[model samples]
Target chain A: MTDTITISVDAMGGDNAPRAVIHGASLALRERKNTRFIFHGRQEQIAPLLDEFPELRPASTVRHCETVIAMDEKPSQALRKGKGTSSMWMAIQAVKDGEADVAISGGNTGALMAMATFCLRPMKGISRPGIAAIWPTLRSDIIVLDMGATIGADAKQLVDYAILGSALARCLFDDDAPTVGLLNVGTEEVKGLDYIKEAGRVLTEASGSGFTYHGFVEGDDIGKGTVDVVVTEGFVGNIALKTAEGTARQVGSYLRSALKSNLMSRIGALFATSALNALRRKMDPRTVNGGVFMGLNGIVIKSHGGTDEIGYKSALSLSYEMARSRLIDKIGDTMQRFPIKVASEAPEAEPEANSA
Target chain B: MTDTITISVDAMGGDNAPRAVIHGASLALRERKNTRFIFHGRQEQIAPLLDEFPELRPASTVRHCETVIAMDEKPSQALRKGKGTSSMWMAIQAVKDGEADVAISGGNTGALMAMATFCLRPMKGISRPGIAAIWPTLRSDIIVLDMGATIGADAKQLVDYAILGSALARCLFDDDAPTVGLLNVGTEEVKGLDYIKEAGRVLTEASGSGFTYHGFVEGDDIGKGTVDVVVTEGFVGNIALKTAEGTARQVGSYLRSALKSNLMSRIGALFATSALNALRRKMDPRTVNGGVFMGLNGIVIKSHGGTDEIGYKSALSLSYEMARSRLIDKIGDTMQRFPIKVASEAPEAEPEANSA
Candidate 1:
């Protein structure tokens, strides 16, 4: 039974708190059947939430970690200072102790990222961890990475991101080695900055590698899904994520207004119920609540802090999928094949001079 | 009739130029009665296109300025080599000779900006001229500056961007002293880097000016039009523009697929024709084709390079409106009214940075 897929939940973390986390765990266990569950937080704090579920009370599989790192504190500082915090200690201990296959959180992003990087560590040959999220766009699915994970990046770093993304795509979708693209201001080779031009050269030169480098892709490409992986600096990635979310919400509202603008449209909406529901399901953030922390030795997920029980359940399901796929081992193998250190060793992390 | 609202046409500009530019001019002239058009380029090259539009040929409105600049050359180089080039010399000569109100382009952005800056010069009190684009978002209209004009900006520049944006919004929209917002990673007071944080303070405090500085706005806020004017670095502004465009295309396509999935849905779409048309109109980029290059001493509008007749029409409509609105005059007034200097004081006659 223990050999089956198992995930540890930071039961005391996130806005939904003890109940949503515990409920998610029970759902994962009941739904997956061969999964074991543990709630990481003080037993006293997590008990009431688990009690609400009732069925999992007799299950001895529930493990308790008695602390929680607050969502608002500095992640790195919280990791060191909040050592006794159940969420932090439990996540690290679970992976170290081999009690759980993966740890998931909807708590402090900085703290989770800090703990994950410091405790679990980056995979061998991996420069830094990247948080990869699948954006549902018009043409196809696009994987956007370094979304608030790696802060400032150079050309080589972005290339490495592309390689990691390709490997992840291969593992995630079993596609015939994905197409990689660097997000830039324009498609022309002369367009963008020195960093982008340099990255483009490296990517183009190494096109014989497993991933297909598709030169330059603009912001609009995220939704076009022309490439499997859209690589960009962390700052840009974060903006892209938020922008897409904002756009989805806006379009959703706009559609609502249009439909309600007239009586005939209202009647049409009633007839198009199934179609609208399908559209909503595809765009629904709750259906894909978890964002995976790739390039790390262990799998970590960042769920939306404002997620409800249904969203939490989706995150749990995503966690199970990651564990079953052995995403970490795959990323490790991929990074080992192509590392970030080969090119940047000469400059030794020198800062760029601002031309503007 | 020709003197009131004159605009110089870069007849040789854009990918499929001569024909497109000439056709657009004729269409604009035919549509807008008060405006006069000047076709500036080699007389030999301009005569044929003028001949094609006989209605425009007899008006003696097309002025001959013989020279043309390649789209890919450096801006400074374009200016230096622009003696015989129709696009450059004409655009420059028109503004300098008072032959046109604004020399609009579908040519090289850097060259247009460079020539405009060197010849007409920056408006007094304006140290750095940033391009402001009126972005249509989910919320209200957003005056986003430095869309690409001045990339790689620091905190001080961003503060100025916010200032310019707010002033533009107030004057243009009569927005009650429009709310100024610094675009950053988070809404929290201390969310982004020192640059962003510093900018945030300037916005909040109004930097000794009575600016209604709204708090920091997230990427999501742009569409909601939450703030009247949103300011950020040029790179960020570019990202926002593309991301918004890409997301809309993606979601719009997705809905189309969903709508066509079943027979009932197709029927539903037929009934919801008005609603769908309304959405289609909102999503069309053609409706908002003309992106103004604000902060320049003279108003220059960039029509899309790939634009068709409709796109040109949109550009003409926007240009005519902007001309009537006195955008340049308002910008100049704002620059003069502001407590800060528009351009750096006491020009050092320092060597230009991009001399090469």
Candidate 2:
């Protein structure tokens, strides 16, 4: 018998709102019979959606919230105004109160991260929480962290991310000792900023401490699956992620036009429809929708605000898997077993800048 | 009558050296009638390759150099050992001595940049030179600069890149007022590091200073053609460029497998061969081979060392276009017209780190 996993959902978050959230929970509940949901949003909006899913209604409970955080609201402003009442806040609050195992939101990333950090607080020995995104690669899925959870990171923080990311990799991939690589401008040992080199040195010293450290990897290595976890400051990591997404979209557009250029090609498209659909399924962003917030006291998975029901269901599934794997305990255990010792000459940590 | 544009070639630089260099020059000369070449490498190797093109033999002169910089050599090591006698050094030296209108090298990038900076020197008021790459977008080609010529950039240096990149944009795209954008994790003004925000403030203040400032653009905007020129530090810029390249390759691989999965798909691929070929041509990396060294006194174009003759020709063509357009003078004029004024409170410049 499996343990029942309860997920707190920000029902009024995301573009599709109550309908997509309720339907997504229904889909997720259908697959995992032991799963339950506590939806936090306005009762008027969510009641009708709940009625439409009779099966989900029995396994779910609604906690009405007065306000919702706007998608474009600044992190600080959202934190100030929506501290206790907003659906986004209440969803995360459920996790803090031990009412739910995980909190999932499709609200603005900055707001979601800010709320998660404030409500759950950072884990012991962790200064800031990093968002670890699962990237699809040619070989296998790789974990990339500091995906815009914070603007910058220092050598110690980078090591923290390494431990956090490797823990997540172990949880998701069932790998006992994941290979980690420091993201740099080049693979050469002497390239990139001082902080990166310092991080590389520390990671080198800490090799076989829960994870094996590959010296350095360039941005291209993310897609090549050069390592199980690619660690970097949030700024570069975020840019690389978005850039890859943009490039994939650009190539898809080119492919679409190529297949529709002429009558013969259109006929070819007809014959290759099934194959192309299979390819589409392989490349679909919905399958990989969750960005797990690492270093937080409790688990919080952020789903893309613009994603549909299918994407939301994927996020819920990720939350379920993470909850069952004891991710937080693993992270704490890794940090305790292999505490990072910063070199005396390592550069001082820079002040954090506000990020959205 | 057109003025004879002389280009210095590092014949022993690339993987298929002397042969590809001489052949690429021959191909470039056929298109641009008023072109001449000064090849710098081993006379024993270049002489035989030159014999194959009778017309090119008369239009080219060979300068012998004994030492060749290895691709894996560090920038500082290459600079110390191959300063005067190396083929790469002599090629840039030709441009400095007015023996050539432009210098072209398919050598190791770090060695080429180091040699170019040492021989030709940086333009006045410029701290370090940047490498501006022509990125293909859906609407048109856009210029992105500081493609790993240096590691980190200050606010002033970023503004300098804006001016430099726009000048390159004007020269290549024939745009009088090219729009420029600072690459950030998010388009929001409050997002990213302090230096990026400071750069944004300065650019906003200097809006009509030769180029129109489009504020901040995320990584996705590069392919969307949201701005005519994207300015960033080399660290992020290099990563974004390589990540995009990797994603395109990944997608292409998926497409290939999809079109060859079964007999029906294989037959479909046969019918769509012409259309697919057209798409392949559009996506070819060779078409955009050059990375122009900006903020330098003389023009230097770096080609991919691993590229073949056709790719080398594209770099040569880019050099010719830049030389003819008076790119250096344009950069100087832009600086003179609208000098960047960084705020007093802006962060101090970080020390340069060695990159390869």
Candidate 3:
């Protein structure tokens, strides 16, 4: 018998609410027959949506939750007001209570993170929790972490991110020893911040700790698939992710305009429609919808709040993969194997420098 | 009579060296008939390259400088060894001595910035110099500054960048009140670091000083052309620029593969050749090769070290425009008009938070 993987979902969270949530689960269930869903939200809204997918209705259980966290609610305020009864909180609580293998939410990222951390608590020895983004590259998908979960990570925290990110790569990529790289301005050893340099030193020393340290990688390397895992503080990671997305959209717009500019090109686009579809599928943000929250006791996937059913399904699939691979255990094991020792003295502060 | 714009060139700096420099100057001269060049490098190599374009020989004078700063050389080490005699140094020296209106180098970025600061010095109140790149956007070009000239800018420095970037935009875009935005993780007033928040508050009060403040903008807004100027510290700005470049290249690669995937697609590509060519031209990095050094005493341009003659020519043309527009004087005027007052007390530190 196939092992059941129960997913706790905050159904009333996203822009599309219970519709996308229930529809997404039905789509996921079609592919993964062993999955069951615990929907946490208003029973009235969720029950109607579940009826639309009779197959999903048989495998789903709706838990009543009166409070819904607003998309724009401050993390602190959301935690204060909706700590126990909110749908977002109940979804995460199901995972903590062992009722669900993992939790998925298409809600406020900050609120989801705050609730997840407050409920699940950070894994032993993990100081900061980070969100790992699965970035598409020329070779394959690479894991980039701390995508604006928090700002200003120290050297120790960066090293922690390295381990967390590597564990994520292992689960997603099915690699035992994934390669990790510290994101920097340049590939040179002497480039970037003090914390980055210190992280490099520690990662080098802890080379065989379930991941290979690929040294420093620049922003371009992220798209180039230079390493399996790329680690950085939240501030830089968030900007890099958004900047790439923007550039892709910008180029996509240019391509659309170019194809429509002339009669010949329009016919050409018709001829190349299938090929263009393949390209579109490759570049589509929906395929990479989930941002996995790492360094926590349980797995939580944050889907894009504005994404539709198709995008939410992608996030669900990722959650299934993570749960089946025992992602949290892997992270915990790596954390224990490679305990980061604080340096007695700070690394020498080098004068600020520029790179080409 | 057209005023002649003299450009100082680091002839033996780039990967192509003297040949690309001389050829580029000739190309620029063809367009802007009233232009002269001071080529600094090994005369023997430069003279032969200059002889290839006999028209350029009359408009150019070669200054023999034996030393050439290696692209990978440390900024401080390069300064210590090649201070006076390096081709890179002599190029900026010409600008300071008023022998040239602007200096253009495809040398080490760090070395160029160091020498430019040492030789020309910063403008009266500018603490840190920034490198501004002209980013191509949906609504034309927007200026993004501090592309890794230095890391970690204070609120005052960010304000200075706003003033400097606004001046460049005014000169290039020909709009007196160009809009400026602070680059952050989120556009919300409460998002990002204390320093960024402080800058936003100051910019709000100082709106219309020279440029109209548009509040905070995210990384995606850069490509959307949400504002005329996107001000960020060097570390984040540099990463964002490279990430965009990488994404564009990645998309271009994907497009090429898609068009060549099948026989019908290949035929379609042939039919839409001109439209495809136009798209290629728009996405070409050569069209935007120069990085303008702002907040400096004189105008300086950094060309991509790996770019060929076509790219080099683009940099030369940008130099001509800056000189004609009197970029330095415009910056000086804006800086004097709005002197940034330091905040009496540090802004309230907000708890670390996450953003979608």
Candidate 4:
């Protein structure tokens, strides 16, 4: 018999709390029979949902908590008020205390990141943590990182992200030598900032030693699957991710409007229902809803706060796969074995007196 | 009666060269009867094509040129080799010498920007030039800028883009106080780099003084029409633009595959041909093919190099509108009227000793 992978879930987190979390866990259990859950919230709220899934009853347990992090709470506020007794914190603490292999929360991103960092801490030799998403592309899925975990990154931080992302890709894709690319404005050698250029040089020198570094990639290259990992500072990465999502939604809306423009088109749409259903499945955002927080000592998957049960189940599945792969240990090993040279910061662009 | 808006066209610039360029100009003339064209390329190549349209013969003039800038030539290389005699250079020089009201080219982007900067120079009190695009949205079209003109910008340069973009918006959208936003990873006050925050503060201070500053906007806001203009550094801006394009194209491909998946869907598609045609029009990249180079003293619209007659005509139409609006002078007047404080450069993130 295989070992049961235990997941700590923050049941009081998300828009549709307790119910969606319990439902998602039950769904996950249905797909993976050797899975166990530790739901953290009010026992009274979660116990009734568990009763509905008798098959999941033997594999699940609940931990009572006094407080829950609010959806819009600032990171600073959440850290101060919701640190110890909150379900979000307790869920992360379960991973820290070795009670669970991974923690999954559909909470505010800022609060979750703050809690995860405070509880699990950054890995050895790493200064900051990054959030990564599995981006769906035309060719295949690629890993994109720093999806708003932090704003800016220095050259060393960028190289660190490359290592972290490469390691994650290795665990998820089972490809040891995943091709990595730094997202930049252009693919040319002399295109970006001093930090990006320096990181490119560092990756070039260390290429064959560990990961295969495929120089620079522009924005379009991400959807084209130009590399296995696309690394950038959080600000650009987050914008790119959201922009792609928004574009897909906008186009979907346009298609809907066009398909209903005339009487003949309305009949055509009815006949093409199955084909349209297949198209909707191909474009479903729920299939890729989880964002994995990397560069930490433990695994934490942050589900979208407003996602449905299907989305939450997808997140849980990703967390199980990551825990099974021992992603944190793999990242630690890769980073420790292969070191990169950080770019020397250039002297400040000299302060010009206010030219008004 | 419209004082004949003379346009200098680089007939040798694009992939289809004189053929597509001449056809596009004929199309433009049909829409705006008072428009006149000064074509720069081999007279033998353009004269025959112009002969196809009898009415265009009187309103068009062709200037013979010995050199043509190649599609793949680097900006720096093009600037060096094709300085004066090349068709692209001569087209811009027409605006510089008052021989034409505006210049339009379907040449390489970098080469076009380099030539425009060299020939037209930036307006007074502006350090760098930015490229602005009119993006179609669900609510209305919005203007997004710094679409890969230069790499990065300080707080001051970003504000300048705000001014330039707003001025263009005022001319095109006729909104006296266009809402402007600085693109960031998040809409919160405490996210993104120090420069973006500083720009936000500066713009906030100057809000009622000129354009309406709408604070920070995230990536999805661009398509949602959250602001009249979205200003960002070139790297992020370029990526957002290209990512949206790639996503739209990717979704289009998916829809095509879905419609052909079954015989019933095939029949459905045939019945919905007109509606599908309308949908195609809405998503056509050709309708938004031009990228306007702002902060320059002259109007220069860069059309996609691979565009056909339809796309080139769109670029020409934009040039006509900008020329009629006198966009260059409007931007200059706005900048000169409301000048804001430029940021004092901060010390660069210190170079850490190589930790490899």
| CA-lDDT, candidates in order | 0.71, 0.87, 0.87, 0.85
State, as a TM-score between 0 and 1, how close model 3 is to the true structure.
0.95
The ten-residue window of minimal lDDT in model 1 chain A covers A347-356
Among the numbered candidates, top DockQ falls to 2
Task: Itemize residue pairs with steric clashes in candidate 3.
Answer: none
lDDT of 2 by residue, B50-168 (tens): 87877898888999999998988877788888989999999999999988989999998888887887777777777778899999988789999889887777787888899899989
Candidate 2 structure quality by residue, lDDT tens digits, A1-356: 13999999999989988788888999999999899999999999999988898999889999999999999987778888899999999999999999999999998888888888888888877777899999999989999998888777778788889999999999999998999998887725244477888888888988898999998898888889899999988988899999899899898988899999998899888889899999999889998999999998899999988998999999999999999998988998889878566642323322222333
Arranged by DockQ with the best first, the candidates are: 2, 4, 3, 1
lDDT of 3 by residue, B1-356 (tens): 13999999999878988788788888989999889889999988988787788999888888999999998987777887788889999999999898999999999888888888888877767777899999999889999998988677789889989999999999999999999999998824233388999888899988988899999899999999999999998999988999999899999999999999999889888878889999999999998999999888899999999998899999999999999999988998887777457542322211111000
TM-score of chain B of each: 0.85, 0.95, 0.94, 0.94
TM-scores for every candidate against the unseen true structure: 0.89, 0.96, 0.95, 0.93
- DockQ for candidate 3: 0.57
Instruction: Report the lDDT tens digits of candidate 4 across residue range B49-161.
Output: 97887788888988888889998887777877778988999999999999899999999788888888888887766777889999998779999999988677789788989
Q: TM-score of candidate 4's chain B against its reference?
A: 0.94
Query: Every prediction's TM-score for the first chain?
Result: 0.89, 0.95, 0.94, 0.93
